[model samples]
Target: MNTSNMDRCLRAALLGIGLALIGAPAIAQDAPVEDAAAPVTESAAAVEPPPPEVQAPSLEQAYQREFAFLQGQKADLERRLAELQDRMGAEQSELEAEIRALEAEVVEMGGEADRLEDRVFESELAVDTARENTDVLASTFLQADFSLAEAYSPDLGDRAPAAEDVSGLFDAALGVLRDAGSIRVEDGEFFLIDGARVDGRIVEIGGIAAYGVSPRGSGVLAPAGDGGLKLWNEDTAEVAEALAAGRAPDSLPIFIFESTATEVEKKGTKGLFDVIRSGGVIGWIIFYLGLLGLALVVLRVVFLQRASASTSKILDAVSGHVRRGDASAALDVLKRKKGSTSRVVSAAIRNLDRDREHLEDIVSEAILHESSHLNRFGAFIMVIAAVSPLLGLLGTVTGMISTFDVITEFGTGDPKLLSGGISIALVTTELGLIVAIPMLVFGNLLSGWAEGIKDDMEKAALRVINQYYEGRARGVESA
Candidate 1:
């Protein structure tokens, strides 16, 4: 049967064999004992010992029977085991085959699923592409309709077809484009420059430009902040008339406009004063400070010029006088001469009788005194240079503050409101830099020039002192 039934039968056969083997020896022993215990049962003993064939089975025979039975049962169990093994092998093979079949089916399904998924993905992609193309078409139609409406008329009305009618929209747009390219004259009323409305024949060269030939005045046409035309310039009357009469003018005086709903005013070039005014009060203040700095620079230049005048000639004259041992003449020459170099040389000459160290001290003192005039306005000019940028920074801070204030009040909707403050901020800073840079450069240059003048004066005085001493030495040697 099955493995479980075969296993039960094999266990039962083994248990029976074990019981027979265990009882066989006890049965043989008991039979002999019983025969002996019978005492006068000699008849029974004799009857039992009558024949081996009629005697009870001995333990050896019983064991041989049990062994034979056990052998038979073992043979039967072995046969059943073989049948179970064969059945199990068959089942295993069938299961393995089934498993393989299922695995193949699963693999096939996986490939099919992959193919299906690819197909689904492609379908989805196609759908998305179609949607995108539909959106593009709709947007194109809307844009075309809007462009046509804005260029030709305020409302498309029946001229613009439905959004779904793409061909109609394109056809209408093309027609409008063709019409716009050619000059078309139409009877219309337009406003003159003096705000008087007059009937006119409007000559439209294209969507970009138009010209009006009115009874009152004929010139180029511009948008009047309404769906109407206005006289832009009276000088273009000839061109407007030529276009109206279907004559091509040699020159086109055209006022190009994008829309008739908004007026475009020609912007004038701003002068220096207008730009400065746009910077507000701070900008004006910076401008004035720049002027002040410039004036200071000029004053310092004049002072330095006067202080440095004829320095070489003064040195030569004093040196010649000192060389001749005419100290008094040298002093007279110094007195008549003007400028820092002459004064320094005079101080050296007056102190010629003194010791060398003392004469040098006098010359240095004279040079120092003249340096005050040479350094005049230099510090103020530098101060202006330093202050101008700081004022600019202050103006910048104030301007930004005002800009923020405007933003806070108006919510930054109109850029014009914010531009004023921004312009002030930038203009003030620009002006400040413009003022500061030159002032700083010139201030440093003038200071360096003043230092150079002082050096020259010291050199002139030293030359005079050397000449005086040399002359004295010669005079003393001659004596």
Candidate 2:
């Protein structure tokens, strides 16, 4: 039998035994007294009481017992569950407390960060305020110094002083004056003052008006509406000569005031002339170059621009007068004419008997002398034209250097910062070309004209020789 079968058999035997013990009657199985036992069975049965019988339990009692057992089990389960719940709640409380502590730490850290940020912001503000104070120019009247008389009561005249006290006072005043700063500048921007439009204290002279001398040399205070400088002649307003607008040549502006009169120190104006001189070196060079070219042009116009008829007029007049037997008139005409041809002809006429070939040589030499005088200083203009552009190129090199410096210092993000060097480069080049072109062109043109005149002089000298000396040779042959 398998284990399950054996177990089942055991459980069945136990159940049957319990049932037999509870309900079954006892049976006698003896053999000696069997007849006796058998004859006395009915009476013994009555005398021996039947085995007491057991009844089945009632359904109500069984149900009550089962219900009580289940109730006890449920009570034990409730006790265990309550213990587990209490342990879990304690753990949850500890975790929550830890979380609260961490949150408080985080809040404290955040407060520290805010405090540091506030300190940084306050420091930055202080630094910005300091920088602004340093950079700002004095912008209001409160920053300016008031005059001594304005600051003090005007009773200095009431106190009399000894000679030593006066000297000491003068010395003290001088020291104060020496230590005093520059005159206060006015904030001249247009602002609404009272109700009228008034300009700043900028002095200007009028073109249409004249200023007479001040009366008794008093202050030149003029009223706002009348007796002031006239911009133009008008019938409406009562106008007079006074300081007015516009800076014209030969105009002067006089400023006068009570209390005290202030003037611009003009401290930086002394170098104005030097600045102009430095900037104008190129201009001076160009001007001198032009003047030199003009001089050469005048010389060429004088000697080279001579009339072609100069020799012919004299030669024709001389031949005509000679045909009429008027040698004196012919000589007079020759004397009036200029240039080598007339001179040679006049010399030949006067010398008459010299070797004709030698006289030709003399005329040639004189023509060369006149050519030299015509071309004076003509080469200098050529040099100026050649060098001017080179000078401009030098300026361009310097400008590029300065331009790179500006880029390094200020950066090229804005083109206006670089424009100054560009102006220098471009303006110099333009001026150079402008100056060189005229000089180069006119200088060569004048030179070519001088050369042509020299050639003409040579030709005229040969013609004069042919007319005078060649004729004399033919005359000797005729004789």
Candidate 3:
């Protein structure tokens, strides 16, 4: 029906025709030979008569032979088709198996891709967390605002930190801790914003605190606005020693900076008088008491000095007149002399006519009288000396009470508010000591001088009396 069937029929017909032609040729040749042989054989006898019954192949016979030939060719074509079909089936089976294997591999690859995506996501999250932690650690562990930490910190951009960056952060934190514990003296140069430079061995106490020991002097280190180190105006020997020895002494407090904290060339202009003035009214009272004591001291000193000279001269004049046997002259000299010594000597000369016992009695009275005059106002000076300190103490107590009142009203938070009372307490006490020491010392000295003058006057008066009695006895003996 189809082209395949048509082609098969054509092939069969062609084969049949080819076979028929070949058979026709053989038949023709056989017929000619038989005819010839029969003719010959007819002459030979009756044997040829049965051969003459043989005839040419009918058309039906030829068709039968051609059909059989065509059938054989069809069988061969069918066998070839069967072979081709079998080979095609085998190839199809192999292709299907390969396709199934490829599908399974694709599924597996998809699963693997999903797992890789998840892992990548997790890795990204971990990196983000690590970056956040690093930032917090950098800010907390190291005070970022401080110059030292700011200098050491790395400038990471917006990206998260890698594994290496995290490791570096840990290293930096460890380094900070190590620096905090360890002490070192380094020879370095420090610069200031104002173009000041210092060359010295910087004593680093962890990076939190720094001090420098230089040929110039020792001082604290402070950070400038320009992120450079500037030596603070304040310094102490104790701090320098501690830094040099790599040991901090107990009770080390914060360093007190100067007026503006930047003025290194000059200190604040506060004198001792300012300190005293800071003490309020109580301090002023204490100060005036001290002045009064000083005044008394000066007056006592002047009086004692004058008494000393007058006593010496009076004794000399009276002794000379009595030794020359001129009692009236000695009395006149005693009257003319001006001092406690002269007064006492005049009393002794007036009673020269009396017996030695009466003269001694009169001289004793005169010496006692003159002793009072010599010691006049001496007690007032000592009292002033003693009272000045007590007044200062009163001021100190009052100031302390005032300070406590301030504390009760407000806490000890503001030193400025409390400083007034404290200054008063301390300054008054200091002024009291200042006033009391000289007063006590000079008072005792003036008292000693007064006693010496009194003693001198008494001795001179007794000697004059003795000489006068001796002269009288000598005159009696001569009579």
Candidate 4:
């Protein structure tokens, strides 16, 4: 049976059973008990009313139903939110992709721009080179009408270029001529002055005359004043205007306006001294001292070397005075001693009277004094030798730093970039060694020579003292 029919049949059977049982309960009431007073009457059995239709719900069931409903709503909301989030994520991804694509396009455009710039630069160089060649060709085909005067300026042929494109040739031409001292870089140009082209050291460059070309063969090169440039047109005997450079402190990097055999002859090979003064304060001081030291060496070799003999003779004279018992005279002679040894002996002689009782004291004092003088410059020479090498080492360290910086900045593809600094550092080291060795050697030799002279002078002074005492003894014997 279907579930609904089955439930109805079961309910009918339960009702019939209840009816049968109800009659039995009624029969059981047939024996009515006698009751006191008011109740001898039989009472019907009490019947319970059918259970009231089940209504409302239990607390647990109510809670469970409410929880289920809330769970269902939460699940629905989660699904909708998830769908919205997924859509947003997709849009974001698309945007990021689009941004990446735009960035790539921008990078490509930048690279294209750089390439185009490089091409333009190359084209400019080519045009410049072409113009220089044109100038050479034109000069080679100079007509009789054309004339060149001072090295600074020259007149060109009357024929102008047929095409406007050909004028670029003059760009290189004018630049070369300007740099050569022929014309001022500021001068605009000398375009066919008086139907002829005149170019030279232009004192003043005027403006492009609205009417083209000046009446006289000369035209304004640019709007006007002068830049003190030497321009000359020897054919016209027109002298160029320029500031005199002869009195400048150092040689300037000026190009020759005119090539003259005499000027080249006069200016022989000039190097570091002309290019730049050694810049650092320390370097400047070192160079100046080097010059002074060089001068001192010359002085010593030429003048002081000759004076040493005279110094020796003075020692001899000092000796003779002591032997003659003229202590005052001997002291005066000692005062005249200027060399290392002489100064030491003079120290002893100055106190001869007090030192007579202890000659050893005299000798000691003199030896110490002489020793100090002899070694005075020796240590200085060694120091100079040491300092030079140290300076070179410092330079090497700095140069290496510079080399590394160059490598970091623009790798080592081109050695030429850093080679010069390295060369300078190495060359400086060599120069330092060259300077130090001779100085150290000479210093040592001079010290040794001074010591030797001091020793000889002391011995001679002692001899003179001994002789004077001997003469006194002989006179005592005669008495």
For each of the candidates, give the backbone clash count: 0, 0, 0, 16
RMSD in order of candidates: 7.1, 22.9, 38.9, 19.0
C-alpha TM-score for every candidate: 0.69, 0.37, 0.51, 0.38
Write one digit per residue (lDDT tens) for candidate 1, span 33-143: 796776666577567654453454555675577667756767787898899999999999999999999999999999999999999999999999987987776567668
Candidate 2: where is the Cα deviation over 4 Å?
1-280, 307-309, 319-331, 339-341, 344-352, 469-479
Deviation from native of the Cα of residue 421 in model 3, angstroms: 1.8
Query: Best by lDDT, which number?
Result: 1
Writing each residue's lDDT as its tens digit, candidate 2 over 1-479 gives: 24465456555655555565445333332433574565656778688875654565544555556556655756676787789899999999999999999999999999999999999999999999876654442221122223333332122233433455445444655555554422222222211112233333322222122222221121122223322321111221111123322223253333332222222121445353343233235534544555676676676566655633465566566765544444467678877777655765565555434676776676667666665666666777788788778766765676677789999999999998887676566655655676688878978888887777656656654554455545655668778
lDDT of each: 0.83, 0.54, 0.72, 0.52
Q: In lDDT terms, how accurate is model 1?
A: 0.83
lDDT by residue (tens digit), candidate 4, 230-263: 2122222111212111122232222332322121
Task: Output the lDDT of residue 466, model 2.
Answer: 56
Sorted on TM-score, highest at the top, how do the candidates line up?
A: 1, 3, 4, 2
The TM-score, computed over Cα atoms with residue i paired to residue i, of candidate 4 is 0.38
lDDT of 4: 0.52
Candidate 2's displacement at residue 280, Å, is 5.6
